[model samples]
Target chain A: MKLATPRRLILPGLAVAVIAGLLSLLAYPFPDALEDSLESHRPETKAAEEAGPRPSSEGSEGWSAPLPDYSVPGVKSEGLGGALAGILGATGTFLALLLLLHVLKGRGRRGPNG
Target chain B: MHIPDGILAPHVWVPLAATGAGAVAVSARAARKRLAEESVPLVGLMGAFVFALQMVNFPIAAGVSDHVVGAGLLAVTFGPGIAVLCMAAVVTIQALVFGDGGIAALGANVVNMAVLSTLTAWAVHQALRPAFPNLAVAVSTVLGVLVGAGGAAAWVMLSQPYGAKFLGAMMVTHLVSGLVEAAVTLAVVKALRASGLVPGDARVVAR
Candidate 1:
């Protein structure tokens, strides 16, 4: 079997990444389900805690993401930072998956479906 | 759902990490054995596509919004093992790089979003495609989202005292989100077929 190249998919993949990056700018700016629920229940949880001791809500206290909340560092514009993060994430995912698959394929005997 | 860090207890995430790692390893082996060398690019592209799609969240209710998980789409396209790998990669990136999800909760997110969702969707599609080819994907997509959401809720429940109210709300919100997910997945799958991105002779499931 011949070694495979993604020549045909390159353009389409780039198109998808670019489109996704642009669309990310339009992503809804609202808390997701878990966060929303937690936020809504916060006051009640606080009141209950005032009444009795409870476990802390801190799962990983003092931890910060490299790109916290998907925004780029020192980016003046929130939209621009988010969009850039989206593009970076999409491109990174593509390369990471490609690399992982390549490693796996390299380890096995080459075949038509390997 | 990207459960942020500091939500799940160590007792919950640690075991899930082990299980998720084991599952990923197994899926990697299966995908390596069955995936066509030529199809490698498709998997990568799909993974990227899924990651991008996740950024766009649709408002399903007055105050609830959720994005397309895309596990159902990948599972229906490339079978469970490959779909799992692609989703695991996407989720890992979202957690580690984007910080959309908790680093400690990565395993739970992977198990919930990738493994459960893909396997459930694949199984549903395989079971129903023979009898109802047209509706199978749609049904499977919806069920996959529900199962994934349920898994997330269960994990959160085990770790926190979120209570049944949170679970109920999560399911209801995800029900609407699942419909949105189904429509998008169906459209994408149709486009993939129409564009001839996926080979006509190829049976994505068997592989």
Candidate 2:
């Protein structure tokens, strides 16, 4: 099982990252299946509806999301914000995984290929 | 599905959080020992791919959409241990940075998507791959979603007695979404193998 050299893998990886980031801009705005299923189970009483939104749990109230719902803060255009967030998120995840794997590398017995 | 905060009771969330953290620790050890030097970049890129793919939710029904969970994809490409670590990273980022899943319920979400989903998918793949390579990838992915969703439903039921009634509905919805997951996983895996990024003998490489 010959491994694809890092050089060979880079182009495809970048293509996927970019394509996925761009495609994320077209993400449907509808609630996901879990959200919809959970919503259906909630009581639809008049008073409950009138109560507005329920409060978030304790210890998490003070926290603020830098890019809430994958939107950039103060970004006027939804499409632009989402796109930027998507790119940023993909980059961040890629970097984070690299750092983690690096730190974990050589901790135990080396793999056969290694 | 990412479980939001406040839904899970303290008792439920606390123990689960500990378990999630412990599982991640063990998986990290396994990954350190088993992961290959040349595979690091591929693993990171795949993690990014999964994270990005998750952002694109496809609407499946009235008021309902779903995204690629990608645990099965990672499981087939790398292995269960590394897949779990990658997914844990993705889920943690979603909760802390994106606020997609609740901070409090992070443990539950991780356990469902990262641990249970990846392991179940890996198990299914290993069990069926020899006899049905293509079929294994698709079926394992669908089953992964089903198991993950079932775990979520179970957590809800344990935390709140009334939540039990929604299990059937949750499974039904996830079954539809699972097919979508299966299709995406199958397509992506086939492409990876064709490109030689993932070898024909993926299992041998993964180990």
Candidate 3:
């Protein structure tokens, strides 16, 4: 079990990050399986639908995401915004994971002198 | 399946999220024992690939769509512990940065998206490998999707009384999409193996 340095992992990880960012632009513009499943369960009663999250409802309004639906704020163009968001998301995820693994890897390695 | 914030009751999401967090913790601890300098880049790059592939959503029937979950690839290539850790990072990023899953329901998203998906795929692959070596990846991947989707459906069903009826719908749709998952995972695994990135059907080095 040999470990590759962070430097060696960077290229491959960044390649994936870039590819994901690019491919994300082509993601289907429709509800995914889970979203579709939830939609199929549309409230039988109008009241139920109204009770749950709506455009101006509890769930939708409760949390405000910086990049809602993966679109950059004030970015009018869907493709550009989504592409930017995808790149950012992919890169961000890679970097975040790298940081996390670094911390995990560093645990208990402290020398007695340090 | 990324569960949004408002749909699930707090009781359901709370426990699911707690379980997700706990599993990540436990998996992290386990992963630490196996974490090696050589394996770090493999896991890191694979995680990036998974996060990237996840964005490509292909259409499926009944207004549903499918994408590469990649848990099978991770579980088979690296083992379940690292797979789960990678998944946690991917899903959490989707939630916080992309708004794919609701923040409130992050727990459910993590569990269905990665925890169950990775674990089930690994379990199925481990069980079938000795017998259906060729088809094991496909079988494991499809079952993984089933588990991920089924677990999500089950959670929603428990939280909502009307949810039970829709379970069949989710399962059926996922079955259709599962084919795509299998194909994609198989392709990626073969590609990884060919590139010498992943050892050939080797037992998890960590395991």
Candidate 4:
């Protein structure tokens, strides 16, 4: 199995990422159904409440992601930061997953021809 | 459907995680068997594309927006096996790298978005393709999102108090989101066909 060149892979990925990054600026930021519903907790939910207080911070209890909530760290422009984060994320995903697929493909090749 | 942390009982997410892991293993095996050497890049690129598209969330109602999952498109283009693998990767990345989803809830997210969506798409497409290929694509794409959302709603009802409202909101918004997802999925499938990026012979393995 062969891999695509950085240019071959990155170019198309960048094109898509840039558009997505830019367009994400317009995405509605309101809480979704799950979040909204969670907030509308009924007083009757003694069971849920007793499970434990909502974690003081959502990701604080676990391994925190570098780009929490898909936003870039220390960027003044929320929109631009989110855009850059999206671009970075797409590129990172491509490289990481490509590596994974590369390994899997290599294993497949080795099984028969190695 | 992104289920954040601090929601869902341990009993719920834990089992879903196990199920997701099993499904991922099954899909990975299926992928290695069906995927050709050259198609590795295709799967990688398709995963990246799905990741990118998911960032652009479209508002489906007054308060909520949904993103293009590419679940149906992936299943249609690559096969159901690869589709599951690709989406599992996409969702994992979104959670671990972007924090778009919660760590505890990742499995439930996968169960909803990856396993269910891909399988539903594959089945619906197979059932509908004999009569109308385009309609099959449309319906499969729509069903993939809707059914996946149903999985999400189930988890929410278990964890949260407002099941009726949550179900209502998710279903109504996702119904519209599903239609948009269908249109985009159909358009991309057509483009892939026209460009000969996805050959007819490549679609393999319903699982």
TM-score of each prediction: 0.90, 0.92, 0.89, 0.88
Could you arrange the candidates by lDDT from highest to lowest? Answer: 2, 1, 4, 3
Model 3 Cα RMSD, Å? 3.0
**Interface RMSD (Å) of model 3?**
2.7
Candidate 2's displacement at residue B162, Å, is 3.3
* Residues B13-90, model 3: lDDT tens digits: 889879999999988877776666456667767777887788888888645677877878788777887889999899
Could you tell me how far off, in angstroms, the CA of residue A16 lies in candidate 1 after the best superposition?
1.7
lDDT digits (tens) for residues A1-114 of candidate 3: 333456656667667766666777877778877777677676577667666532122344555778888789999998888888877777777678777877776772564222
Order of quality (DockQ): 2, 3, 1, 4
TM-score of chain B of 1: 0.96
For model 1, residues B70-101, the per-residue Cα lDDT tens digits are 98998888888888999999999887777777
Tens digit of per-residue lDDT, candidate 2, span A19-72:
566888787779887777667765355654453223265536877668888888
Which 10 residues in a row give candidate 3 chain B its minimum summed lDDT?
Answer: B198-207
By summed lDDT, the worst window of 10 consecutive residues in model 1 chain B runs over B198-207
Query: On DockQ, who's better, 1 or 3?
Result: 3
Give the best candidate by DockQ: 2
Q: In order, what DockQ does each candidate have?
A: 0.47, 0.55, 0.53, 0.43
Error of 3 at B119 (Å): 0.7
What fraction of correct interface contacts does each candidate retain?
0.58, 0.63, 0.62, 0.47
Clashing pairs in 3: A2-B38, A3-B37, A3-B38, A4-B37, A4-B38
TM-score of the first chain of model 2 = 0.73
Give model 4 RMSD, 1 decimal.
Answer: 3.3
